[model samples]
Target chain A: MTDDATRGPDPAAMLAVAEEQQARALRLLEPDGAVIYGAWGVAWLVGPGLMWLSRAHDVLPIGVAGAVFAALLLGAGAVTAVHVGRRTQGVQGVSQQTGALHGWSWFLGFATLTAIMAATARAGASDDLLALLWTALSCLVVGVLYMAAGALWRDLVQYSIGVWILVIGAAGALAGVPTNQLLMSLAGGGVFLGAAALSRLRRRA
Target chain B: MTSGPTLNGLDPVIHAESRLRITATLAAVDRGDRLSFPRLQKLLDMTAGNLSTHLRRLEDAGYVEVTKTFEGRTPATYLALTDPGRVAFATYTAALRALLRPTDGGSA
Candidate 1:
């Protein structure tokens, strides 16, 4: 013990190192950042249901589902971009790159899914298969994005949420399309919205 | 392996504390990662004048790339590390590690 005290670095220098580490913590965003992602989740959750209802009943608004889909896409993107652009005014590297990746992956995934839906419809596949494919593809996009986000930011909660989506998607597929749609609404959208709320609460705390 | 931890290998250009911190911070991001000037200022918490001075030193070394652009009415300055800068930072880290390692024959 006596020998250690004589050889160790100065206490003041060590304190400075500790303080620097604390300041570095600010490099990470507050939980409110993730709350914006909840909007995307809500879109995923409700979009399928709206589509199903739109087809089932023609009495409702003419293009409600399609309109909602477009709205959610643009709306979520705008809101999240604004939130990130403002929140990340200073910490620009990781957050900025992650945002770009998130946007591109979602955009590409949605485009691919839309193409798949169109092709299947033209190919005369059963609606059940079409629904399953839709759910599966949607789930995959959510899962991959979540996992990528988690890996980039090193966030376990977001990563786990991705896993949850993958599992929910898989289970829904196995059970069939109707079940898958419900799960997308419940487990898929449900958990996202829930996590967003939780993030909000944590930020307040 | 000589007598003790070595400092002879450190790049003199980035040897100082503030500069080392700045380089390390920049290095943590990807090669092309551009950080807004205001953001970098906040991250380093140094006076704008002093920060600019240090940045100028690194710029002269060809280690940092700086860009100035207008975001609406405001001018935004973005900074990223050049390839040479990244290599220099990596070399600096290796040297620092070699310096901090124990001199005794125990494997670490």
Candidate 2:
């Protein structure tokens, strides 16, 4: 065998080809930015709704109820997000890892919004007109929330319809309306029931 | 024809063992959310340095990305799979599935 010094030098072209392969291999994976995006959206929807509830209860002595409700709902959201993150810790794929985050964001956002509106109503806002207006807006916004979540999860359920009722009820309440609870009830109740419907469908399938 | 190892989309040597484990772990949790470093290390049953080295390799490959932020005074490490990593893992799984499927002759 020839000595190391006598061996022909490694081909320059071969080294270039190997380097190119390494670079190409490294180019394939990009971190899933969607996870962060979903988390931010969830935070935004809940945070604003919580703050609004605190403001709506201006008549209340210390806004204790509103603040408590905000803490609970937001706390729940944060817990859920952390739980999901832990669960998917080493998982691959954007779609698979984001499933829980998407679900958590949708439900928490809706619940927080609903609770805020309810707190506003109970705060002794004597102006039925303003109460109605705020409630209607909450319904519409909740509907949009449901719609967003539904699209992500890909199943149409009663929860989506509930959003519509919340919107309509708020409108009626604003227009000197009386006894328009059905809309609000449907929207609020729809969330739990909608989740159930999806579960049932999955089981049957 | 005998099928062999491939990289990305091209035939190449199989990935290192540590990297392979990281990929499998991530793939299993794809339907969930992010994973913390401590949890990942525990699940992989690896030393902190070992797992960190493996993670660095995967991150260099662009299959995973790490986010470091402070939770109060403590630092937190969160990991998530990138879109390309997901696709690569899926393809790898499909190939494995195909290989594992029973053939017409009743031997895999």
Candidate 3:
């Protein structure tokens, strides 16, 4: 093989190419932020919005509202799975493993938390108390998970969303029942939608 | 006086412009992660023939691994940097930095 002395390309030009290619690679690796954030935003808004509407007005039955909320959450989960899977398709290695493990963590975390909450309800927790507990704890889990993801990826937008969710969750708990639902539907959902827009703008920039 | 190996230390295998760009792109991926041939070509904006030629050179030097497989009914080609490739690229960058470093300790 020839040495660098025999090669004619300037070192500075090569360095520039390296930097440019690296940036391109990273961009290709990043999942579509707008889709992810938007899916959650829609779910957060409509799900809790329905719940609050049922509570405030006698429009839909609470049972139906609850069912819709659960369904929306499931839909959001499915979207996240599909989006991530498609993006990483044909790629293998530590990144794929990391994504798989992280996805399982969310599933396991919610399943365990739900089981514990259900147990509390069975043990004579009042319906109102159960509702507040579920809301607070659910938000707490999402907040913590988002923050953990942000830290792992070093994404400021995700970290900020986590902080906002935690704050909203706390405020909603203190506000109580119907008000809490409204707060979550408005404040919680609002932040998610706002973040989605911001993410899109940042991508464009 | 100069202390160690200078610009002469740069790996000729990776020193070429196209090969350097290819190596840099592959290096950005997570260890062991691979990029599809079409994807890498698009990223580099190189013609398939051009990319294949450079890739062969890198593969020859044991710096790259190219895998051919079937994705459903379609043929697919994926490429990744071998461990030795990573080391070579790292060493190349270090030597490049050394060469670029101002001899009087000024900013490069």
Q: Provide the overall lDDT of each model, using Cα atoms, as 2-decimal numbers.
A: 0.69, 0.51, 0.83
Per-chain TM-score of chain A in candidate 2 equals 0.40
Give the Å shift of residue B28 in candidate 1.
7.4
Comparing 2 with 3 on lDDT, the higher-scoring candidate is 3
Candidate 2 DockQ vs. native = 0.09
lDDT of 3 by residue, B21-100 (tens): 88998998888688889878877788898889888888988899998989899999999999999998998887777777
Clashing pairs in 1: A90-B39
Show model 1 residue runs off by greater than 4 Å.
A1-33, A49-63, A87-103, A125-129, A148-154, A197-205, B1-34, B42-47, B53-108
Winner on lDDT (1 vs 3): 3
| DockQ score of the complex predicted as candidate 1 | 0.16
Second chain of candidate 3: TM-score?
Answer: 0.88
TM-score of each: 0.59, 0.45, 0.77
Model 2, residue A153: distance off in Å is 6.8
Best by DockQ: 3
The regions of model 2 sitting more than 4 angstroms off are A1-126, A152-178, A193-205, B1-21, B27-36, B42-50, B53-84, B105-108
True contacts kept of each: 0.19, 0.08, 0.56
- Flag the better candidate by TM-score, 2 or 3: 3
